[model samples]
Target: MERGFRLILAASLMLMLLDLCRGSTIGVCYGRNADDLPTPDKAAQLVQQHNIKYVRIYDSNIQVFKAFANTGIELMIGIPNSDLLPFAQFQSNADSWLKNNILPYYPSTKITYITVGAEATEVNSTSLVVPAMQNVFTALRKAGLHKKIKVSTTHSLGVLSRSFPPSAGAFNSSFASFLKPLLIFLAENKSPFMVDIYPYYAFRDSPNNVSLDYALFESSSEVIDPNTGLLYTNMFDAQIDALYFALAALNFRTIKIMVTETGWPSKGSPKETAATPDNAQTYNTNLIRHVINDTGTPAKPGEELDVYIFSLFNENRKPGLDSERNWGLFYPDKTSVYNLDFSGRGSVDVITGANITNTNGTTWCIASSNASDRVLQSALDWACGPGNVDCSPIQPSQPCYEPDTLVSHASYAFNSFYQQNGASDVACSFGGLGVRVDKNPSYDKCLYMTTGSNKTLSTNATAIPTTSHSLAGKVHTSKSSWTFMISFLLFLAIDSIRGW
Candidate 1:
C-alpha cells in the first residue's frame, strides 16, 4: 500500500507540473474600478479556485497584492491616471509608492509589471499620460526596479478614427500629439502599447454596419480590408490593426502593442439592453482563442498580440454603465458568471493542475483565430465572398478595392480605410492582386505585415505556374540548328515589335 501510494503521488506531481506550465500563460485583468467587492484575501482564493495564473489590476491595492503573494500568480499592477502628473512632478512620490506598495511585497507577491495608467489615452482620460510614464520610468529606475518591472499605459480603441481593413492602420490625428510621445516611450522601454478594444462595443454601437458574425467570432463572417486586400473573418484583429495604422502613420510602426483591457459584459443596463449571456460567451470564446492559439493579425501575420481580459468577478459596486459592472468571468459569490470554456478550461470535474493554454473557446472565438472550426463556412460564403458590405461609407471617387476573387472582394472593402490619412504603395506582387506581406525582416525595411511571423508563408510562388525546362536551354539546345535559328529570328522580330 505504501509503494502504491508513493507511485500515485509521484504521478500526480508530474501531472500538476505540466498543468501549471500550461496555465502559466493566459491571464485575467482583475479591475477594481468599483468600490465594493470581495476583500483581497478572499478574491485571491477565488482566482486560485478557478486555476487562473495571471491577474492584472488597475491600482496597486496592497490587500489585493498581498493576497496573491507566494501564490505564483503573475500580476500586473497600475497607477491611476490622475497620479501621473504627481508622479511626474515628484520621483520621490514614485519611490514612496513603490516602497509602500511594491518593494516589501514583491517576489512573494509575484508583482510583474507596473502599468502607468489604465487606457490613459482612452475616452474621458487625461492627456498627461506621456509625462506620467516618463516620471514612472525615472522613479522605477531610482528605486532600481525598472529592469525587473515594465512601465506602460493602456488606451481605448477610440484612439483610431477608423479601423476596418487590417492593412490600413492609422490613429486619429487629433490624438496624435499625445500618442506620438507615448508610442516613443513604449518603444524605448521595450513596453507594449496597450488598448482596450471591444468588438462587442462596435457591434452594439454600429449594429447596422458591423456584422454579428464578425463580432461574434463566428466562422461565416468574412471581412476584407481594401488597402491591403486581406480577408478577415473577425473584428478583433481589425481593431488592433487600427491602432497599428495610427501608430504607423505617426512613424512609430515598430512599437509592439497589446490589448490591456478587453471583454464583453454578460449583463447590461436597460439602455444597453442588447447585452446578453450568449454574446458574452461568444466574445470571450473567440477573444481567448486569439490570445492562446497565436493567431497573427491581418497586418502582422504570425505575430501574437498579448491580451488581458477585463475582470475576474462582477463588481456590484461599479457605477455608470451597466456593462461596466458586467464584465466578470465570475460573480462576487465565487461562482462563474457564464459557462464558456477557454481551452475547455474548468475546475469543476477535477481540480489538479492548470489547463491554461487557452483553447479557442470550446464554444467562442473559433474562426481564423484557431482550434475550433465552429464557423459554418457555407453560411458566410456570400458575405465574405464578394459585393457584401454596402459601400455608402467610402465615397465613389476614392480608389477602393475592386471586387475580384472571393478573397479580393472582401479584403478591398476594408483596405480603402484611410486612418493614417495616406497611402504608400499599392502593388499586388501575387498575380498583381491579393494580399501581400512585406517580405523584409530588417529594421529599416517595413515588411508588409500579414498574419505571419518568422517566415509566415511556408513556400513562395505556390500559385504561380511554371515549366520545368529552361526556355533558353530548350530553344538553343534544339538538335536542329535550322529550327533554333528560326526561333531566334522569331524572337528578334517579336522584340523589335515590342520596341525592345
Candidate 2:
C-alpha cells in the first residue's frame, strides 16, 4: 500500500512539473520578402512588445541576428532552397555558412532550430533535403552547438497524397524513398518534422465539403472518423492528426511535429470572399489559443504542439493569388491588420477598415443568467482557486460584497480572470457559465478591471474602504509548490496510518 501510494505521488509530481516547465509554443514567422517592411531592429521591438517570445526568420540576416540579441526571444533561423545544393554538396560550405551566419550571434540570440530548406517536396528538390540537413548537423556538431540547435527542413501539405478522415492519412508513394530516409534522420537526431498547414486553402478549394466554422475553429458540430471513431471538432486538428497518422504509418510515431507556417489572410481579390478581416482574426486568434492551451489533436491529446503563425508582415512581392500576399498579422508599417491577442488569453473581433488601429473594446465577463447556482459556485471556486483570481474584493464587508449573491461573486471572479488573461473569450468561458457583455458591471463603490488601457472603472461617488489590488501583481501558485505541499501532507498521513 505504501509503495503504491508513493508511486501515485511520484506520477502526480512528474505531471505537475511537466505542466509548469512548458513554455509558450506559439511563434510568428518573420518573412521579409517586401521592400516596405520595417528594419529588423524595429520589427524585433514590435514583436517583443506584443509578448511574443518565439520568432522564425527565413534567413540569417546579420541585421536580424543583431537586433534580436539579448532580447531573450528564441529564434528558428532558416536556410533558403537556393543554398541547398551548395550546403549538401560540400561540408566546408555548410561550415563556412554557419561560421559566417550563426556562430557570432548564437547563445546571445537564442537561435534554436536551423531549417535547411522549405517546401522542398513542392520544389522537386526532395533529394537534397536529407543530405543538406546531415551536412548542417555535422557543421553544428563540429562547432559543439549541434545539441543546442536542431537541423531540419519544412514541407508543404502537398507531400501527403491522402488526408481524409484523418485516420487514413498517408504520404504519397512517389516520395517514400525521400521521406523514409528523412524520417529516420529526424527520429535519430530527435528533430521535429516541420510542416506548413493551411486550412484556409483546403476550405477555399472545396467550400461545399469543408465548413467555414470548422476551418476557423468555431464549429458547433463534430466530425467523427468512421474507422477510428475519433471525433474532430475543427479542421486544424484533423489536418494535424492526419499528419500524425501518416508519420505513425511510416513507423516514425516517436517523431514530433512542428507547424512551421500557418495563418489566414485579412484581404483578398474579388473571388476570395472568405479572406476577410473577420475570418483572419478568428482563425489566427483561435489558432493561438488552441496551440498555447496545449489542446493537442485527437490522436495526441495533451501533447505540447509548437506552432508558428505565418508571415509577420504582408509581402507585396509575394507572387500568386491576392490572398498569398495578405497572410501577415501586421502590415509593412508594423501596425496590426486586426486585433489579435498573441498572448493567447483573449479573443479578437472582426475589424472593417483600411489601415485601422487595433483596440481593445469595452468587454466584461459575467455569470450567465441561465446557468444554475451550483455551476456558478463551481466555476467561482475554480476561478478563485487554481485560476488564481483575486477574490478578496467580493468577500464580506468588501466593495463588491453587496447583494452577497453567488452569481454576483462569480461574475467578479470570472471577469478578474478574464481581464487578467487578455480579455479573451476563452478566459471568460467558465464551462459555459460565464457570458461576455459590453456594459460595465461596476456598481456603488465596487470597480471592475478592464484591459490594459483603462485599468478600472470609476464612479461619480467617493470610493469605499477597500484593499487595493493590481492585476499586474497577481500572484500565481506554482504547480511545483502545490505538488510539494500535497506530497508532504500525503507522507504525513501515510506515516500516521502506518503507526495506527
Candidate 3:
C-alpha cells in the first residue's frame, strides 16, 4: 500500500511538470526600425494594457529596458549582427556588454533569454555566431546569472536547402560548418533553437503549387509527407517539422524549437494580393487560438510551443519587399492594424470583418473570380472529401450540374463550406480559392442556400463555431495534485491500521 501511494505521488508530480510545460506563453516581437513610433514607455504600457506577458526586442535599448521594469513582463533581448564578430574575438567585450546591458535591470525587468544576434547565419561573418554565443554564456556564468538567463541565436527558414517533405529537411551545405558546433552548444546548455517561419513567403514564391488555404491554416485538406507519413494540415506545422527532422538528422533532437518570428503582412505590393487586412487578421487570430489550445505540430503533438509574432508595430523605413515593412500587429500610431485580441477572448467575426453583431441577413460565400483552375480543383476536392461539403446538387444529373465546369461545381461546393462554417473570412478563404458575397448564386431549380433562402442553412452554420483544430479543454492539473494528496492520506491510514 505504501509503495502504491509513493508511485501515485511521483506520477502526480510528473503530471504537474507536464502541465507547466504545456502552458507556454504567446509573445510578440517588438521591433524598432521606424522613426515615427511611440516612446518605449508608452509601448510598454500598450503591451501591459493588451495583457501580453512575453515580448522580444531586437536590441537591449536602455529606454525599453527601463520601461519594462517592474511591469511583470518577460523579455528576450538581442545583440545586433554587427556586434557578433567583436564579441566572438574577445571575452572582455562580452563581459562589458553584460555588465552594462544586463546586470543593471535584470530581475526587475525579467530578462529570460539573450538572443546573440538576429539571423546571424545570414550575415557574411556567420562563423562568429557560436563563439559569440559561448562568450555570452561565459559572461552570464561569471555574473552568477547563467541559470536565470539562456543564450542562443535565431535563424531564418532560408537556411534550409529543402523543406517540402519536412522529413527531408536539411540545412544548406554552406551553413553546416557553423551549425554543427552551434547545435552542440545549444544541446549542452539546454537552450531552444529559435527560427523565423513565414508561410506567406512559400505561397508568394509558388502560388500555383502551394494552397492558400494551407498557408492560412484554414484548410480541411491535409498534406501527407510521404517520407514520414506525418499528416500536415497547414504550412506552419510543415515548417516546424522540417526543422525537427533537420535537428534529428544532426542528432540534436532534444533541443526545443521556438518561433522568434512569424506573422502575415496586412498590406503588400501589387503582386502580393494575399497580404490583405482580412487575411492578416485571420492568420494571427487563428494562430493565437492554435497556441492557446496547446496543440503542437503534427510531429510533436501535445507539446507546448513558444512563439513570438513578427512585430508589435509596423515600421515605415524597413527595406525589402513591401510586405517586409508591414508585418506589425499595430500601426506606428499604436492602433491595431485590425481587431485582434491577443488574450484569446476576441470573436472570429471581429477579425474577418464579418461584423457578426450586425448581419444584413443576406450573404453567401463563393469561389473568387481570380481563383485559377488548379487552385479551384484542389479546393473542390477538399470540400467534397475531408470538408464533407454536400456535392449531390453539383452532380451530373442534378440541377446545379448543367454548367458542368470545374469553376461552376467548385463555386457551389465552396459556398456550401463557407456557409456551413459561418461565412467568416477564414471559412471563405480556401487558400485564396474562395470569397464571400452578398448576392446568392442560386438559379431556378439550383437553389443555392443563403440567409433568405433557407432557415436550415442558417441553423447549420454553427454560428462562429470554434475551430475544428481547437485543443481547448480542462488541463486536469489539479486532479493530479488532489490525487497525490489523497494517496498520501491513504498511506497514513494503512500505517495506522498496521499499528492497531
Q: What TM-score fits each model?
A: 0.63, 0.72, 0.69
Scanning candidate 3 in windows of ten residues, the lowest lDDT window is 469-478
Q: On a 0 to 100 scale, what is the lDDT of residue 445 in model 3?
A: 61
Q: Which residue runs does candidate 2 get wrong by more than 4 Å?
A: 1-20, 347-500
lDDT (10s digit) by residue, model 3, range 76-108 = 999999888889999999999999988898899
Candidate 2 lDDT over 321-378, as tens digits, reads 8998999989988888987765454422221222222233568889987887755666
Candidate lDDT scores, in order, read: 0.57, 0.79, 0.75
How big is the positional error of residue 87 in model 3, measured in Å on the Cα after superposition?
A: 0.5
- Which runs in model 1 stand beyond 4 Å of their true positions? 1-25, 33-36, 122-127, 271-273, 344-500
| Of 1 and 3, the candidate ranking higher by TM-score | 3
lDDT of 1: 0.57
Candidate 3 stretches with Cα past 4 Å from truth are 1-21, 345-500
Q: Using lDDT as the measure, name the better of candidate 2 and candidate 3.
A: 2
Prediction RMSDs, each to the true structure: 23.4, 10.7, 16.7
Q: Among all windows of ten consecutive residues in candidate 1, which has the lowest summed lDDT?
A: 469-478
